[model samples]
Target: MLNFGNMHNSVWIGVDIGTTGVRAIAYQKNGVNLCDSNEFYPLETPYPDWAEQNPEIIYKATEKVIRDTANTLIYKGIPVSGIAISTVMHSFAPANEKRELLSNMITWADSRSVEIVNELKKDIKLTRNFYEKTCCPVHACYPFLKILWLKKTFPDVFSKMKYIYSLKDYVFEKLTNKWVIDKSSASASGLYNAHKMDWDEDILSFADIRKEQLPPVVSTTYSQKLTPDAAQRLNLPKGLPVVIGATDGVLVNVGIGAVKPGQLSATIGTSGAIRMLTKNPKVDKKNRTWCYNLTDDMWVAGGAINNGGIIMRWMRDKICHYNSRRLDDIDIDPYDLMTLKASKIPAGAEGLLLLPFFTGERAPYWNSELRGMFFGLSLNHSRSHMIRAAMEGICFSLNCVLTALKDFGKIEDIRVSGSFTKSTLWLQIISDIFGENITLPQNSEGAAFGAAVLGFIASGEMNSISDTANLIQSKKIYYPQKENFLTYKELFDIYNNLYQKLQPEFTRITTYQNQMYK
Candidate 1:
């Protein structure tokens, strides 16, 4: 068993604001986790193509985790040197100058801006120019399209229309009274110029928004003192340094010490992405991948799938409905129970295949019209077979991203992280599908750990950010089996063929589904 809470000296707090919720972990030097706490919120999908979370609700969840963690540190008499934050990218909401949220947080999974994106793509020159400047694809996930949707949807007479920012800026402003964003988040906004390191006036004008209406972009390591009121609420000392860490996708790589050029990070949480660090800004000419700044010198190139462990969660709660306890009252993790059932099935899932795009798709396709599918389902297939097929589908989708990422360079090592590491079956499945060796970190602390390291670096607790590389270690490695690898490769081809053939059908279904609801 891996001992994650290995004791060490020097305490710093790292807070990660995620899609479903937030987590705060206090850590010591050398990647030792001292204490942590978590709080969860809701992702409400009241309408098709709309995934919304209340910004205030998310901020309250973040504040709760940080407060709980700070109280734990105080109880232990551990004086933390500083705190850092990592937030999800492309999560936007409108607010007034006083920071009052005017709308629900439109998250990365939201595809309500599809029509706006389609309209802009008619002008290929403008769209291509925007992609070249910002390194963000013409997708609904970026605020560039979302801003257009907002302008077209909400009228000035009914809207507050004072300012616009993401949930990260919302949370940060609540804590420090600063209207700013880290470059990592800004670079992904599709309004920021990747080369100039500021907002693009051309895109801003096209989106019908002014520069002053957006948050000022700053470096990933920029920090400020926590406000007196916020500090008191969290029960931490006043004037505590709050480092504005990078996006969660970038920070996860830092957490794992996958800093070298060829070291790749494959993460599956609520969503899945394959990321690699590049020394300079890199944009895919095919518009199949995205590049975001980690620092002025470091950029992350990758693709993200809107589906991941979330599919398994659906299989648990809706398909199988497996309770967490057995008849004998023995406690079992729901995911483990699902995995146990799936392991009994063979590698190919016996002709069962799933598209797994329940919430549209990102990365290579960036198509919002694609819906979920269960193709080639046979009478022989059971819930376990379908579950395993979903897992394989997610892996196959991530492989699409990995293929685009290969353009950056040869990916020598693939490091897998997130809660999915608990399932040996899932790990082996990903390894087989990708036909690559998968390495699991000993601690897999991820974004929170990376955030704390950034806090330490920003607060002078650490001499250099490179010091973190020496702290990360690998725990176990899973190699691809030739038989299963060949099976997955054949199935992967079939998967792509199915996706290509079903495009028009998916688009038709999505249109009728939306029209019916309206």
Candidate 2:
């Protein structure tokens, strides 16, 4: 038997399943960490432009984190109030009615559906009509396009499949024996109606799918009890409430207290995005941004980029001789070494610029055919210059989304989160590029903490989402320097112009590469 604790000491657990890893955090109502655990899994790329993860592997990782965190709290006499979930948006796989996945989970980084997306874009009116209802652009990153790609490529799998499952839905089903999707996850699937708050029938017909084929849509606050199997695995009570939380991007805003209009929440996780909450759902006609649900009454309008910290990961593992942190015998992080070397290089990388579309961009460009490159490379440039330019390119890509949100009114506050927060040089680069002071909260687990907040509300521990603001305290603030800002502004303009001028070349080179590999 465990000792009962004061209500004030009750901890809410939030489990966030991301692209490359899973994080479970136990947070008290006062924004302090009681216990936490993390585990990483591989992103399988069997073919060019394909990104996938085994559903079983990801689920096991999630189970370990949640169990580990729950066990630690149990050992410490800290009572766990409830648990909540957050996951990457748009990760999909086909399944049987029994909810067995037909294949590995297709991640957002996969761009195999570019041809289908291109075909969809050819119909301007139809694309606009779909965007009006779904608030998703005609892009390869969405599940709708992935389904089309699957049908065309793997007819056998498509014929055998009876249901579609997002990553969160799979985990929820395993835990509670229920298959359902939160509104935030469904909204980004490119088949849910943001206005009507359900599956878009027109898109259903367009995909030759039915409402029955997708999980029932529910609120982020929806809660279920753990099943006998899940209860045994986690060593928690069977009746423990498991709140279905929002998607990663939206939840990060909630975690950082950037829930108001004009308050921007910028994230650079496995990917990057710039988001702001709004009272109404809005879509960009230019197809530069996507809008999704945070709650029935709230919407998140923003843009996302495929390349962020992953670029740094590539520079570390592929360019540098260092092995992955886990596999390497070295005591230091390769990222820290890269940052230190990059800080020594002057801004602008001595006239060299890199376009960070390594995984194909999402927001602003929404072009999967785009490929990354270094312009103005010369023998004079060294490894330090190359690293600095790569980091600058990532900030430049994020700035593209910030530029699109100009219609959201001038940003009242800029708050950022993710692993990138630990690197002072990277934060300074962001601050200088945007010419604004960026603030970091004491708690960096934005998505995970947001899920915990939902758990609190669903379990009747908290009254409202807005109550989260008071629990958090500002940690550090990075201010832009005048000289660096001026230099970055000029480079930003050049970055935009370069993409415009070389647009055709991108399409051509991508076509040749695809033909050769595939």
Measured with C-alpha atoms, the lDDT of residue 494 in candidate 1 is 95
For candidate 1, lDDT tens digit of each residue in 232-337?
A: 9999877787888888998888888887879899999899999988877788878899889987678888888999987887888789987665623776677877
Off by over 4 Å in 1: 1-9, 157-159, 323-329
lDDT of 2 by residue, 1-518 (tens): 21223456567889989999999999988778888999999988766688999989999999999999989988987777778999999988999767678899999999999989888899999999998889999899999999989989998998888999999898999998888999999999999999999999989888888889999999999988888889899988776878899999999988988876677888988899999988899988587999999877888999999998888888887787676655356677778889899999998899999999877789999999999999989999998998999989999999999988987688878899998888889889999999999988888789999998887777667876777777767899899999999999999999999999998998998889889875
Top candidate on TM-score is 2
The TM-score measured for candidate 1 stands at 0.96
Model 1: pairs clashing at backbone N, Cα or C within 3 Å = none
Deviation in Å, model 2, residue 136 alpha carbon: 0.5
Candidate 2: deviation at residue 212, Å? Answer: 0.5
Q: Estimate each model's TM-score.
A: 0.96, 0.97
